[model samples]
Target: MDSPSTPRWRKSSHSNGDGGSCVEVDDANPGHVRDSKDPNGPSLAFAPSAWNAFVSAVRDGEFSGI
Candidate 1:
């Protein structure tokens, strides 16, 4: 398990200025995701391949208007 301090969180570039929806990621751990609104809350981690697939889908507009 990664220590609480291990992952350096970065807010998504796609995050809106209004702060309605926010996503944060740990680039060091390509599979980890946490809410920017709750840094200390539970997070979800995906497998490397799964994360890649998800990112690809997003880039391809598979999840547009979401």
Candidate 2:
């Protein structure tokens, strides 16, 4: 994995324009995620396949109850 500085982060499209909870993603880095509220905070990174599976699950409503 590359250093955090190498990942160019962008806010998730699903995030609300209002001041709701938001997450930023580094698409170039596959699974890097950081809170929009805290860009300088810690980030969580996942394996590419794991990230894709999680995204698919979310889109498929597998975690709707959460």
lDDT of 1 at 32: 94
What is the C-alpha local distance difference test score of each model? 0.87, 0.87
| Per-residue lDDT over 1-66 for candidate 1, one digit per residue giving the tens place of the 0 to 100 score | 654457878998878989867999998788899989998899998988999999999899998886
How many clashing residue pairs appear in each of the predictions shown?
0, 0
| Residue-level lDDT tens digits of model 2 in 1-66 | 456557888999878899687999997788889998988899999988999999999899998797
Candidate 2: lDDT over CA atoms? Answer: 0.87
Which ranges in model 2 have alpha carbons more than 4 Å from their true place?
1-5
Tell me, what's the RMSD of every candidate? 2.5, 2.1
**Model 2 TM-score, 2 decimals:** 0.80
Q: What value does the lDDT take at residue 33 in candidate 2?
A: 94
